[model samples]
Target: MLSDLQRETRDEEIWKIKILSEMQRLKISFYFWREKTNNNLSYTSLMGPDKLKILKEFDLSAVFQSKTRAEQIRALWNQFYKLYLLMQNKTTTKKIFCHESQAWLDAFLAPSTGHPNKNNFVRGMYRTQDVTPYIHVLVNHVGEFLEIHQEFGLAAFSCSAVEKKNHMQVCLYFQNTLKDGGHENSQKSAILEMLEHENQQLYFALNETPNFFEAPKKFRLE
Candidate 1:
């Protein structure tokens, strides 16, 4: 006979496989598997949008058939989806943080008071799972940061743009700059080439004019 802990572990593994299969069927592109060399799952490609989609769409009903556990998981996911939506809030011109959303964050990070409330779901989760460092920072420090910067919202502190720029630069370097003989023939340093590429992009952007007129109706543009 299997021990209780072993059975639980087996069930969890089976559930993970089912979830992954479902996500694949749904064409969700977030990474969930461990790399060959590393035991931990790669989160480098997991962006805010991916997280929001997974939280919103990934069904926990198949994994947690128990009413109590399913309800708890749903509540937790709903809280996460709300948090992501708040973070992704944008103005007409650009991304902006809304201070009004902090109330939801506070509710999410609230301590369990032994009553039936939003905090109870998080409390139940904490009881079952180990709190990671990211969770600790989000629960404790995020609110403090928001308090310190009352004028700014969470979007102001987001690193998405920086990450995107870095990814673009890496692609440029590998595909365009370092192609022939690993940059031995080129007179310019890799850093200088990258700088030049950025300058050229900026120049083009500044020189480009916006076309205010709409395309003709019969053009059949895709």
Candidate 2:
């Protein structure tokens, strides 16, 4: 069961995947460049006020000019990569898909792991070398997410009870309904209903005891 925040993160990932697929399709057809003449007016004006507002929030801008096709693609990738990191504001180094180091064996048993007889050291060393450039890029791009995750210890928060309970109820409802010839649309409706019920339960519980976190009440010195 994913918490509301996790669901938001998943939705963002889905949106990024769609955007990246479109970019890849364009890249294959050389759509980002203009043949015969070096003009980028369309690119510069591609995103109007709404997009500019979003870019301003993250200190990002569309690169409308590049000397080479490779540079243009690289710029696009960099922009999307930064956007991805910004959206996923609580990711760990282990979760970084592109350039994660695999040095667990070496860390645990350095002398034995680094021996010539063992190939673990060789594989780990080469993998590190191959991804060195990407590692640098990730470090520069995702520093904000890393910093926030570390500062807040976001991973410490487990899936909320309300979310898990709702998930279980929905799953049970789906399974029971399936036996009665329930369809996909019905399953979705059932899940939504379960979620609504859980939400109301949470609202009532919070109303009954507002200080759920047990925060200390302030007292006047006078």
Candidate 3:
């Protein structure tokens, strides 16, 4: 007969294998690390949105589930959701005052005020895992930035729109511009072609009118 501790260990190993198999089925990549002391650690290659989707999709009240396993998973998912909400709250364009900044710091650092769950989540994550440099900056310096720029929010300083525009430009350039050879043995410059295409797009945007009504609700507003 197996001892209680041995049975528990066996169950844990089985659960780990099942979870890893499920992750593989979902096309999630698992990475294993080997350090100097022969310690093996593993993590999945899930992005932020992926993590959110997984946490949101997993239901604890589903049928044929182990209660203990479900509770453990739910607790971890709640922690991740709390962190997600905290990040979403911080990344907005709404003005944050000095007091609000302090509140945000409190919610970010210690688990005593504001949203204690989010604070505890961050604190627990920091204690258990290796956080990125961005997280380090978010924990230490973002509150200061918010306090100094109380007139505007962090969205004012975001580069996401610029990055997206650059991405679109690169796609357009690749699709429309010629690489090397052109008619009359002339070497066509892709950069020049891209600029001309951009100018044409701008001209159309400025001058062209839609045949269909853009805002039918506006026509009915009288």
Clashes of each: 0, 0, 0
**Candidate 2, residues 47-81: lDDT per residue as tens digits?**
34434433333221122111232233344445544
Tens digits of lDDT, candidate 1, 3-90: 2223345664665666667577667764456778867644335565665676777666655545555566577668766655654443
Residue clash pairs of candidate 2: none
- What TM-score fits each model? 0.44, 0.21, 0.34
Candidate 1, residue 131: how far the Cα is off, in Å: 2.7
lDDT of 3 by residue, 161-207 (tens): 88799998789777887764478577678888888877877777788
> Which residue pairs clash in candidate 3?
none
Return the clash pairs for model 1, or none. none
* RMSD per model, one decimal: 12.6, 24.4, 15.8
Deviation from native of the Cα of residue 140 in model 3, angstroms: 12
lDDT score, candidate 3: 0.53
Where's the lowest-lDDT run of ten residues in candidate 1? 91-100
- How far residue 20's Cα lies from its native spot in candidate 2, in Å, is 44
